[model samples]
Target: MSATRDLHDLGQSLWLDNITRDMLGDGTLAAHISDRDVTGLTSNPTIFEHAVAAGDAYDGSIRASVEAGKDGEGAFFDLALEDITRAADLFRPIHDKTDGVDGFVSLEVSPQLVRDTAATLAQAKELHARGDRPNLFIKIPGTPEGLPAIEEAIFAGIPVNVTLLFDAKQYLAAADAYLRGIERRVEAGLNPQVASVASIFISRWDVAVKDSAPEGYKNRLGIAVVQQAYVAYLELVASARVQRLLNEGARPQRALWASTGTKDPEASDTLYIEAFASPLTVNTMPEKTLIAFADHGKVGEPLARDGGDSEQVLAAFEAAGIGVDALAERLQQEGADAFQKSWDSLLEQIATKSQALTA
Candidate 1:
């Protein structure tokens, strides 16, 4: 069996971290779903930016939107939604088969609203309503301001993929917001089955501390952090509060591992996928990494629910003068900033394309 099938059989979800019109039109995404067992997908501003800039697929759409007097972000989202809705439809079968537990496609709200809670909530709701797909998740950052919006969106029955989380603390905070929203629904005598996922980014930790950590610790930070988070996730599900909600028909928010693409050339290309193979968690990998894993990946023992050796490894980092708390905050900020930069570039690309096509 292919390693991708191995991972799926191990109960870990392998989602593609990309989407494009060509992939959809050419049966590439469908082939992955059929052959590689890919169950879900994720998209961000950067992904859309690349998709728009790389091909003539979006040019006609952008030109039409421009003629209709839409430009910049407005024009871009129309094109993005066109692709996402189609992808969502393709995954709708698995979505129904799994009863909404898997087979999700995520669309991120504009990063420009990262700090604006009100606007973020509005856009999330608008996009969720516009897409009108049950399997679609509107991604919201896990920033301080975004937590409230996450809760609001969840309470309103919209599935959310909470992005930009860096550590266990951030992950728990996002989870808390999700629980709060569900608890509210329970109190109001509403169904609490609104699904959500807290996306904790991996790989960035190793990238952040590679030069600073000693040789032995160079590529180990990211996995250790994920292990720690997974432990916390297990504990939370077993907690009395969460258990109470579970009894009331509410589901625990699943933790998803994002940014799994390996950044270090010397490290194993499947480093994150192999190290963090835990059940009930989603790992969205880039296309290259997914292909690499399907070709030569080895499925190792699953991640320990008890977080074996994670505390010890974290302590080692502390001893080496690495302040994890401070670094987490820094990384989240950097991630938000990077998305904003990408969003700006994407809008610029749309303008350039629109003008050329219209002329």
Candidate 2:
């Protein structure tokens, strides 16, 4: 069996961290589903920006959306939803097979809404309604401003994929917001089984510390941080609070490994995917990383529930003058800013493309 299928059989979901209208139309995404075991996908401003700017693949759609009176962000979301909803439909069977746990395609709200809770919540509701696909998850950042929006979005019964979490603390904060949302639902006599996933980014950690770290610490910080988070995840899953919620029919918010692609050319392409091989979590890899893994990646034993040497490795970083807490905050902020930049560029691309296509 392919290593992709091996990971799936091990119970760790493998989701593609990309989607393009061309791929959807050409059966590329379908091939990943059948041959490589990719059950779902995710999209963001950067991904969409690249798709729209790459070629004339979306030219006809852009012309139509423009003719239909859509412009700026309106036209972009219309274009994006067209692709995301179709991907969601393709994953619908896996979604049904897993009872809404596995198959989900995520669409993020406007990154500009990151600081404004009300705007974020409003746009989330709007996008969720606009998509109208049960398997679609409207992504919200896990920033301080975004936590309240996440809780409110969940209480409002919209499934969420909480993004931009960098460490266990951020992951826990995101998880708390999700639980609070479920609690509100149960209190109001509503269904508490809203699906959600907290995405924790890897690789960026190693890149951040690469220059200062000693040789022994190279490419290890990210794995240690994720291991620590996995230990916390196991504990949370076994906690009495979560147990009570399960009994109340509320679904658990699963952990997702994002940014798994190795940025450093010297490192293994499948570094993060192999490190995070375990059940009950999701690893969303880039197309390049996914293909590399299928071609030759090996799945090792599952991560130790005790976190193995994570604590020790982290202590070494601390002793070497690295502060994990402060670094986590900085990474999340930087990630949010990067997405906003991409969103701005995406809008510009849409406006330019629509004009060129019309002419």
lDDT of 2 by residue, 1-359 (tens): 89998999999999999988889999999999999999889888899989988888888888888999998888888889999999999999999999989899999999999999999999999999999999999999999999999999999999999999999999999999999999999999999989999999998899899898755989999999999999888899899989999999987899999999999899889889999998999999999999999999999998888999999999999999999889999999999999999999989988998878888
Per-candidate TM equals: 0.99, 0.98
Q: How accurate is candidate 2 locally (lDDT)?
A: 0.93
Task: Mark the regions of model 2 whose C-alpha exceeds 4 Å error after superposition.
Answer: none
lDDT of predicted model 1: 0.93
Model 1 ranges with Cα > 4 A deviation: none
